[model samples]
Target: MIDTRMIGDVRVTRIHEYSGPTHDPKFLLPDLSQELLESNREWMSPHHWIPLMNKLILTVQLWVVHAGSNIIVVDTGVGNRKPREGMARMHNLNSLVLEWLEAAGAPPDKVTHVALTHLHMDHVGWNTRWLDGRWTPTFPNARYYLPQDDFLFCESGRNKQEGLDVFGASFEDSVMPIVDAGMSVMLKPGMEIGDCLQVEDARGHSPGQVAFRIRSRGEEAIFSGDICHNPIQIVHPEINSGYCIWPDQARKTRMEFLASSADRETLVLPVHFGNPYAGFVRREGAGFRFEPLLW
Candidate 1:
């Protein structure tokens, strides 16, 4: 079943497009020591940790938010066809992203906004689709609110200097098409798309990385982008994915984000958390922990 739950007034549904092992622990987040995994094995096993392969099981999902007649998407998971070199697992492949969206009754055209927390390959893949021998904006009517800094940064082609040009082609295919289609908007921090949704900058993973805080009748949930990819980071906030462009900035942003989420008892909706893609943040000694929302 498609995981759908009401958060105050917004209907937040998880369209789990893909799930499996993507990165080895050492490669996913090098700072995460084996000792840390062993210490937390009692809790993480079977669901999150794969000891044999040492890979953290993660999911690529898109969160669809229904607010005041607006259908907003937070991150479009890996799209169907793209030349995602080096990332063979989900590259040049077929995906059910759109079909699942349709099954949920939220077709691409009905989508009002496609707010990408950042312009990463996986997050922006479905922003466009292969059409007529060329990539084109997938959501014809949705105004995509991408971060200004990120759009410009990626546009500048500086991602090559950052060493993950693996996403270079993705920018050319998924993002640029939206801009050409005149459906892309540069997001500003504190930008409000609706009374229930507001944007906040959470840079580090990407220059323009942003998170959305949705509030309705005082109930709140945060759509935290790649600030922390897996539940393991909730326990060890210092760890950063190897894809992070600014390591120090990424770590700082993560710890602070976790602290606030824990203090506020906010529901955190992340892009790559495994099975239960949405959860709450809780303080666990000096760090924090993810309490998955089974509902």
Candidate 2:
């Protein structure tokens, strides 16, 4: 299923890719306590958490924004036939992302800009596809906007030795092809795209992770990449997903982003979150809470 919302004149749609019980609660969030999980069970159950399986449910999706003449796709989900040797769930397989994209009104050829919040296996997979026996840019007409620090970090081979399959192989297949094709633009902090979207520093989950702020006609929303994998994080802002490379920074960034969203009343659209994937952050007592957007 696809869900869309209009922020003024810009039409933003969430294209579904994969959704299931992805990780153990404690494994995904080391700080999670049984009490905390029970406290939020009323809202998190079924959609965000599976009490029966004791797993945290996550969704891998793409956020396509239609602003004026620009059809910008944010964070492509895992593509077909990628080598995710360590992650069995993400290993070589076929996903109907392209068809989903087409159904959502932003096909590969029609996409004008491809903005990546960060360079991770799941987020960059569809950036390229197997074409004519070689990996090639999926959106031939689009210019990909990649985070500068991540590009440098991945290019340096620093993550090659990391046991987790977040970078090395996927980088070569998904990202490098775009760079080699000269269709990549290194995004910097405060970068603006078409005067509608602004890139802000949202690192910590990955070296150069970012969140895009979409503004139009006094309405606003944020394409928050992985700042909070699950809505539970909004209630417990300090919790970091197991995939987070820099736990401390990740927590700090999440807390700040939640507070800012609550204060600004900005719609928060995270890449992962089950049903009602986007929401508004509400300040609750010492922390914050997620008010899922029904649309």
Candidate 3:
């Protein structure tokens, strides 16, 4: 189920669902080659790998949103019963997130907007659900938002989605319905939905990837999609995940995000990384480190 928290007047929620070995330890390590690690001085640190193997499973967060007039879902996460690639092993379909939303006073039908950080399988799985023998948009009344560049890059057909089918059907089954229904919004940087929300250019992780900046009741928060996978990644922004389409650009984006906002009191909502949703960035050494806020 999803956990809920309120930052001033803005309500932030997250769906704790995923598709993978719940207790796998390998995800904690940077997706780097041994040779690359050996040659790079920056990647060599005690914090390079977490010692508590058992805690690794707690990482990966499926974030949800209840910002302003919209019940915005940042990433849908891996949906139930969908075939996945890599370590994604999800099952037993249930709407724990919807339950949490109801408990938080936001019902499914009341949701006005659904936003995606990227098009990875895990981020878009819950975008649709199996019903009547077909996948359909879960939010019946909401307008689905996706970056145009991200949509084109993933659906371009130039790259092989050999192991990324979990994310494929979302566009065809889930997202297309909204587009066909006229409830889809494609955004560029600086786009404003209302007085309290704005979109910022946060590319690299995915081309044209954008982060949502929310301001309300004198508080500020940025839903940082996959800018940093783990808290450790904050201090090692140079490390790249195997799935990053453009590693060099991803690395640069990570650095810029850290340098621009880590020291300030901005609340950063990263997609993954165990508990403690919001945090401030700190400069530990050559790289920046995440200081998660304790709830």
Candidate 4:
């Protein structure tokens, strides 16, 4: 079933692509503490962590927000039939993101805008589709937004993604097609969409990554894409994901976002969080905690 919720009149839903053990805690998150995991097993077991295999569970899902007359889809998960290498789990696969969107009542062509947090292969795969040997924009009628810095860096072949053979084709397949189709709008750090949405410069995971903030009727929510890959990072905010291009900056941005979420009581929805992919951040000692929320 498609999980639905509302922050004022904005109808929000989650369209999942895949949900399972995407990586080992040690490999993806280099600074995970075994001691913390063992102590927190009572709450983390079977949901966030698989202690037996020492694997961290994650979800690749899309956040669909229906605000005013706009249907904004954030961070499309890996789509079907991409020649993904190195990243074996996401390589050349089929996903139910579109079907689930339909079930949730947000069909493809009806989507007015599609926004990406960054240009990573996993995050932007659905921006285009493989059709008749050509990569094409999957959302034919939607205006796509991408971070200007990321688009430039990746296009220059200087970004970390370019060095990795597996993601070498990502820029061409996922980003260029949108730009070529005249559907991509390169945005800077602080662009606001109407009065209900804005971009937060949350770099680190990528050289030019950003997060989305939405507000309506005095309520607030943030789509914090890839800042914190695991629930453990809420407590150990210092840990950097293997994919982070700017580790120091990523950690700093993460800390700031978490603090803000805790203080403002904003609903923090992440792209790769499991099941109840969102929650409220709370003060827990010197760090913070994720309070899973479902609607």
lDDT of 2 by residue, 121-205 (tens): 8899999999899999999999999999989988877777565446658789999999999999999889997567899999999
Q: What lDDT tens digits, residue by residue, belong to model 4 across residues 170-231?
A: 78888898999899888777897534569889988887789889887888888898998877
* Candidate 3 lDDT for residue 36: 42
- Compare the candidates by lDDT and give the number of the best one: 2
lDDT of 1 by residue, 27-120 (tens): 8877888998889887677568787777888888898988888888889878887887677877887877788888876899998898889988
lDDT of 3 by residue, 201-234 (tens): 8787667678878777767778888877656567
Candidates' lDDT values, in order?
0.84, 0.89, 0.64, 0.82
How close to the true structure is residue 258 of candidate 3, measured as C-alpha lDDT? 83
TM-score of 2: 0.96
Collision count for each candidate, in order: 0, 0, 3, 0
Off by over 4 Å in 1: none
Global fold similarity of model 4 (TM-score): 0.95
- Give the runs in model 3 whose Cα sits over 4 Å from its true position: 18-55, 58-60, 85-88, 91-95, 161-169
Least lDDT summed over 10 consecutive residues: which range in candidate 1?
A: 160-169
Candidate 4 lDDT at 267 equals: 93
**CA deviation > 4 Å runs, candidate 2:** 161-165
CA error at residue 153 for candidate 2, angstroms: 0.8
